[model samples]
Target: MAMQGTLLEFILGWLMIPWRIFVEIYRHAFPPANEAGEHEHEGMLDASSGDITIDKRELSHWTKLSQQWWDPEGDFALLHGFNHCRIPMILDAYSKYIAQKPLPDTNPLRGAKIIDVGCGAGFVSEPLREYGADITGVDMVPAVIELAKAHWNERHPTEIGPDYLCTSVEEISSQRPEEFDMVLCLEVLDHVANWKEFAAQSCRLLRPGGCAIFSTINRTLAALIIAIIGGEHLLRIVPMDTHHLRKFIKPSEVEYELNKHGLVQVNLTGCTPVDPWARRPRWSDVSYCGVTYAITAVKRA
Candidate 1:
């Protein structure tokens, strides 16, 4: 049996070679092309074609990893684990702001319109749809957007799937002002050159009473050590250069941006594992050790 299993593994490994070669050849031949083509937009921060705020290096890095975006056990494994703590916080903040108890597990977000900026391959968008939100996921990479659309079709080809667009928040907001009730622009702050201006666009995309939840590493000594040194350099949980130390936004900066955009900050939480030794899932944490944090803000009615 052991020999049989080893033989099977060997055969499978050999079988993957041609497919891998084919994929490489295809990617090189039909490369994702220009960064400008990655996003379709004409609005604030980028009022014309070829003017988006995305960091070219960052977009390229993400585009290179587009194939792994939906694989929970792949390059985004840590982020996949991080979402266990994040999703609940988003649900709780939205429920509390409306003076309602948590919605039931089944389709809790029914009848809500949601926008997820930088939603690469729909890991967040897919689950949110299960909870019943009409989700519109936007990203600025053609390869990434194509992967997301393919994932959705393979997973739910006929259902009312989330609308995934290859665009930026500025363009989307210009096209559909005051359309969404909630925006989940989580973990996307550190990748853009115009984060503040883009944040204001998130506010502009929401209805009067809508809310947005943003998450990213705080720009601090702690984050420099943990997020950059430990995670990126030593562990390589994400691609090298995927995060820039200087681009990490401070919590206060997030507050200022939200407030400046006519949105009031409501909740800020440090997310960490409840217990580490037991290989436990993460939980909401109040301590601001500065590795990763999230902010929830609301647009006043």
Candidate 2:
């Protein structure tokens, strides 16, 4: 059995060679939109001012997944399990760095004002609400925003959960600058056409000394193999076109953007699966940040 398993692994590895070569050829032929200077005009909603960051392709892609957003055993199963790692990180960061106090056993995040940008179907928002945080969940996709609202209403009929909004982060930042105590922008950086602007607006939403947390895939060969090829194609864990290789932002890029926006980098942690089959993520060291990682930054007071 062991020999057979090894042979199977070897065969699979060999089979992936062609796919890998194809990916490299495609990458060289058509570089990242930003690198190729396509962002000069492409993905711009308004050519006059060029302030909008909504990628229509990304928006349409997510809209197709709106109905499956809440399905745990469906395409978003990984995201559902990912809450276990991210929620704790949020709570700990707020308590240690922001509040500078011990978290209460119950209602740990009471009185905390948080905004969940790119919040799909209120998955993260609902958990934060249970921990007593006042959350406002926002998404560019109208269908998912409505789905988030409907789900939140169904689950918490009497108690008000997160306030769901179908709006871009740029618009929200302009409307309510420096209003939130914490900003949660998980798994969003890679999807935006203008990640720098998207990140800037996310940081702008935070009050002085407020924390902004972000999670995204690193732009690396490992990420291409695992995230794009293995996860999307072989395992079929997520839908194809869910992620683009060129759009994956490096951790250094994230840190630079935060620092440029007057936010200091606080924490950077790598997240990896517990096992080959498990969806549960375990926190790893920075060296393992090739696949997925999370960043925590605080606005300078």
Candidate 3:
């Protein structure tokens, strides 16, 4: 068994697929930009209300797995199990600020508005809604958004869930600038070519004093060894090509990029693949290292 695992890891590690092909495919899906650099086409992929970034292979890839998104131990299990750490990290970040009313039992985040950027099948958005947040989830993939919307409504028809959109953060932020209390880009930064633009969009979407939280992989030798060779190849926790080495950003990189976009880092913490305390063995972090982490940044007033 050990030899098999090692062999599998060795074979898969060599599968370092290039990301540019995916980018070119997406570009072909839309019209060429004119001299002004504006997208000549806007409605492709059902993102009529928004424009798309250059790299969007992740969207097209994940859209195929929409049916398994909500399954706890399925293809998206890493994200499913991550709720334990993610919810706590987000709540802890918000708890520091002073507010007029006391936290409500039913919805601690009542009256607050949150935008879940790159929300896959409404995983983060639906749960946040129970906390009384007026949530809006945006993703570049129209098919995934439709699937997520249908699933959310069918499961929680009575509950106030997120308003899911088939759009990019860039488009939505432009439409309603400086309008959210919090913006979350969980497990998404590494998948897009427009990370810097995404950071800028977060700043535009946030109200004065509003915050943005991002969870993504760190660029390190250890990360490539463990996350790629071990997780994707050997253990098969996530899909192959789920992570792109070129897209991984360092921790300081995120701080610096967001800072340049007028957002200040409040807190950052490392995360493991699953929560350790869960009865089932899952992903969780032992300490704040330079691995995978969650970062909270507040937009300046």
List RMSD in Å for every model shown. 9.7, 4.4, 6.3
Candidate 1 stretches with Cα past 4 Å from truth are: 1-51, 275-284
TM-score for all models, in order of appearance: 0.80, 0.88, 0.80
- Candidate 1, residues 136-157, lDDT tens digits: the string is 9999899988998888789887
lDDT of 3 by residue, 1-301 (tens): 1122356555654453234334423443542453123232231232343444435456567777778787766667667777877886666666664243346567788787888998878877888887877899998777778888888789888866788988777778889998888889898887765577677786789888888898898877677666666566656666666775556789898899888888888888887744433323445554765668878888788
lDDT of each candidate versus the true structure: 0.73, 0.81, 0.71
Model 2, position 171, has a per-residue lDDT of 81
Q: What is the lDDT ranking, best to worst?
A: 2, 1, 3
lDDT of 3 at 23: 43
